[model samples]
Target: MASFEINGGKRLQGELVPQGAKNEALQVLCAVLMTPEKVTISNLPDIIDVNKLINLLQAMGVKIEKVERGTFIFQAKDIDLDYLQTEDFKNRASSLRGSIMIVGPLLARYGKGFMPKPGGDKIGRRRLDTHFEGFAKLGAKFNFDQQAYFYSVTAEKLKGTYIHLDEASVTGTANVLMAAVLAEGKTTIYNAACEPYLQQLCKMLNKMGAKISGISSNMLTIEGVSELGGCFHRVLPDMIEIGSFIGLAAMTQSEITIKDVSYENLGIIPQTFQRLGIDMELRGDDLFIPSQESYQVDTFIDGSILTIADAPWPGFTPDLLSIVLVTATQAMGSVLIHQKMFESRLFFVDKLIDMGAQIILCDPHRATVIGLDRKHSLKGIQMTSPDIRAGVSLLIAALSAEGKSVIHNIEQIDRGYQDIDLRLNNLGADIRRM
Candidate 1:
């Protein structure tokens, strides 16, 4: 269990390039299983989760060639189905929530898929019901082994049908979409998640000879094909990391330039940070955050308190709400952060409260933050990272605080961010891995 020893109250400056999207990487890596031809992927983030998925694919007999640092060519020519039932496979797959995605491509190509109960951040109850339900709607028989905590879906041949998802779950939509691409007929998915990552997946699938339409809408149409071929794909820059950098800049009063951010794809993220009074400008696909003496939060037009909440696509992302809450601690006004998707995400505010931020944890789903406005610098203390996003949030708070702070369980941070301590240290941050 490595920890971060941070010397707080240091201003940083430099150009930071965001890594490839982790969420999209997971989905695309699984998509490689649907084709036997060479599928080339670029801009893959070197993070724990993505690397784990790559290793899992390799274990399943996918031939992978590293063309460059963030580029790989994968050919799933000889996948070993029997490996899925092994204890080693179960132990590896059970540790990654992204492993659930493998079931879709496996079912599409092999007519059957099996997985141990997947694991991920302990943020909340992230159910796999949507994925299995969508599969069941598409003519797949689902079974669960309660004794082993395993799930399996099998089908002789999947026939596409209309599916109105109960929730616009991103991974669920991706899973079903992957399965539908190889089904026998047209599949229409209503209430689908239209995130950029999903759109990227659709585009890559289409390039691989799968027919898909409604690129950026709630409803998607997929025409089942005989088979899919390989295609080259590049993942978008991680918007969550971009949002984290924005918050870090505001919290530390630093001028930082984030390079090649795929500015257009970052829906409402920049504006949301601006709503928190964090000034940022677009400089030809890059985001420039100037050092701020202080920022002010905005209120509703009718003079009500400002509220930021997460919803399906086009709404603020729930992943960044933790960063927003931590960033708002130094703003000039107050804002309510409602984490509608997950209940326990707001529980991290207690650590911030200990760091001298004025936050009211109204409930498991909401928090109200009254900005200290830099009148008093936060005093760092020992803390443990709860999850990936919250870990980065606490790191941001510690960077802007006074005195020394020790952050334990930094493995959580490493799961998402790539070499976070080394990257931040390059930007003049005092983060030492101990």
Candidate 2:
């Protein structure tokens, strides 16, 4: 297990260019399997999860060539379908949560797909029902192996139909959309996840000859094409990372400029932080967060306590809630962070509380953080990272805390953020990776 040794209580100053979207990269990389032609994708993040998915594709016989850093050309001309039955394939597929997405393209082009129970962050119960259920709606026969925890979908031909999702799941919507693009006739998906990354997928697919309408809306209509062709696509900057950098700047009292953020796509993220009383200046495409001694949480118009909750698109993202909770530690007022999607996401408050933040773990879904308002500084302590978001949140806390802090299991952090320590160190943060 890798660990990060951080020396805290120093203000940082520099610019950070956010990496390409991790969530978007996962979806589009899997989409390469739907076509035999070459697809050139740029701005790919060099993170563990993204790299894992890329490697998984390569193992399945997709010819991949590196054009340069953050760019690749993929051709699925000769995919070895027999490899799907191997134990090596099962083990590799089961380890990555994103691997479940490959089933969509495989089932679309090859008439069958199989995946073991996919693995990812243990934030809560991330069910695969949405994916398989959507597949079943598209005329695919679905089966599950109880003993092996395996899932399989097969069909001679898929016929698209109307699908109203149980939940607006991003991955679920992506999986179903990929399958429906090659199905016979039209597919209308209501209540689809309209996240920017999902929209990026739709745009990419449209460019590749898939007739997809409603690019930025929940109701997506896809007119199935006989086959999809190759198209060049570039991923947007990761909004979650941009949000993290904003919080980090405020918490550590750093003047950091996040460049080429694709500001318009970051729905509600900037305003959500501003509601926390963090001052930011939007200079063209860059977000400049100046150093602050103390920031304040805003109250409702009726003077009630501010509640920051996560919802579907156009609402604040749940991924950055952990960052928000940690940033509020030194703010001027209290804010309630309601993590609606995942139950265990708020469980990381114990680590922050140990670091001297006044946080109340109301339950599994919510946390009330009472800002110290800079009257007190968090004292450093050794801790372990539970998940990706929590790990980065803890790292941010450590950077703003007093003395030294040791964080174990930094692989969780590496899975999402690319070269986090080195990037922050360039901006004057004292973090040693071991």
Candidate 3:
């Protein structure tokens, strides 16, 4: 029920460090359950979602030590099987989508896994078909209790097989991959997600003695081993956070530097922002963005209005589309933002429209933004954040608006971004948490 009270029209300036990948932390944390030895993970995002998953793991009898800030050591040798059937475990598991990942490692190691319906942002329908379908292909028996809304999968011993996923769902890929790592024989997965988070997951699994190839491609080959050992793995910087910062700088006309971004992994994000007329320079490990009074959107080579849309990987990520959409409201041109994965994500455009930004919501998934070109700045308004990504988008708009803006229901924002209000305040943003 907390709110962000922001005085707008303030430019942010400073070097802000990006937090560790939230998506990667979820996948890596679950992958730790594949081994019984000590596994140390560093640069873990201290966000609400991650902490909830960690607490769930601790409740399940996994030995976890908070070695230091943003670091944890995990040993899953003493998992309590009885706890998995408890009401507390079910309630906690239903609260986190990351809990679905535990099904894979548990099934692989102990031949059984059960979970309640996983919950997360209600942007759209996020189905668990890919995870269960992949498991069934590997000889697991899948059953669902409609009355309890519970799902369970069991196997005597998994036998690897080829699987062609219906979609390259990120969490689905991670879950299936974890299950296949300890199964017998070889497993080939076509159309698997190859995002940086998945790349890190594969590398970590390999370090733990799993045979996996095709690191950056949609096709992955895994040779199942009998067991896995512990390994130390560090998550890459959050690209979503970097994108949000760049959008914030552009909309507020601020000079900001994002440090240690691991540029090699941010494949096409920078160039995508460039299309929105953002000027960014990658200096070693830092991305420097200078203040600008006005930035114009780029047209296509054919002189047509540019369209920004989300795709699988190496394409514009759907996670950052909200930032891009909000940033477009201040640019000097018109751009169509299409969010393909989630239907309801684009509904937040109504809030921006209320703030005096000219926008057209074409459908549940498309928004056409007519930039003000800085002819007049947006007027601050009161709004409630719909989700994690939309919350930050509103915050960005509030920083660039004329008056003051109040954002309620910020718990959604806290689920992903790590202390975002404090971090932005450090960079001179006039934001107060109330």
Candidate 4:
């Protein structure tokens, strides 16, 4: 029931150190269950989803110790497999999408695994059929009950095989990678998700003795190994937060510098934003966003209207489309945004329309945004965060609007960004967490 009260129309100017990648942190935490030795992860973000995942791991008897402020030492040497069947475990397991990944490691190490339906953004129907399908292909049998989804594999030894995933689902790819690492033969996953988060998972697995090739491509080759050892790995910076900061600076007419961003890993993000006429400078590893009065949407070379769409990794991320849509509302021109990954993601544009934004909801999957160009200021109003990315988008809108705005259901925002209100406050934004 917490909310954010934001007084809008302030120019933010300061330097911000981005936190560790939330997506990678979740996967790395679950990977600890695959080994009995100690695993140390550095640059961990202090966020709610991570804390919840850590609590779930601790409940299952994983020993976690804080080595430093943003570092942790975790050892799953004495994991109690029985905890995975309890009611408390089911409730906690169903609280986040990252919890689904535990099934692979558990089933690979232990013969069986059980978890309830996972929870995440309600943007659309996120199916676990892909995960189960990939697991079943890897010799795991799946069963469902009224209370939870149960998975058990009867094969005495798992034998790897080729898997062509139905879609390049991020978590699905992670599950398959985790399961394939301990199987018997060579496993080739075609049409995989090669995002930076997945790449980090691959690197960490290699550190733990998993033979994985094709680090940043769709075709992943994994040679199953008998045992995995412990190793220390550092998680990457949060690119989604970096994208959010880019959107915030453009929307509020602010000059801000984001520090420690992995410039090379930002494959298409920088160029994607440039499509909207938001130019950014990379000073070594940092990103600098200069203050701008208005951004213009670029047109096609042939003089047709520009269209920006989301695709799999190496393409634009579906998660950042919300931020782009919201930021485009305050830009100088018009563009079409197509969010192909989720059906319900574009439904939040109605909230922006209520705030006097010029948006045309073409359908559930696409919208055309006409920028207001600093000529019109969005009026303050009460709004609810429908999902994680949309929550951050609404916060940006609230911050760019004229009076006071209240954003309810901030727990969704807490799932991804770390201390968002406080960080924005440090950048001279008038945001208070209430």
Clashing pairs in 2: none
Number of backbone collisions per candidate: 0, 0, 0, 0
Select the stronger candidate by lDDT from 3 and 4: 3
After TM-score superposition, the amount by which residue 137's alpha carbon in candidate 4 deviates from its true location, in angstroms, is 1.5
lDDT of 4 by residue, 87-159 (tens): 8888898887799999888878876677788888888889888888888898877787753454444345677
How many backbone overlaps does candidate 1 show? 0
Q: In model 3, which runs have C-alpha deviations exceeding 4 angstroms?
A: none
Model 1 earns a TM-score of 0.99
Encode model 2's per-residue lDDT on 379-416: one tens digit a residue: 89999999999999999999999999999999999999
- Stretches of candidate 1 exceeding 4 Å from the true structure: none
What's the C-alpha lDDT at position 399 in model 4? 93
Ranking by lDDT: 1, 2, 3, 4
Worst 10 residues of 2 by lDDT: 346-355
**Whole-structure CA lDDT of model 4:** 0.90
Candidate no. 2 TM-score: 0.99
Lowest summed lDDT over 10 consecutive residues: which window, candidate 3? 422-431
The 10-residue segment of model 1 with minimum total lDDT is 341-350
TM-score of each candidate? Answer: 0.99, 0.99, 0.99, 0.98
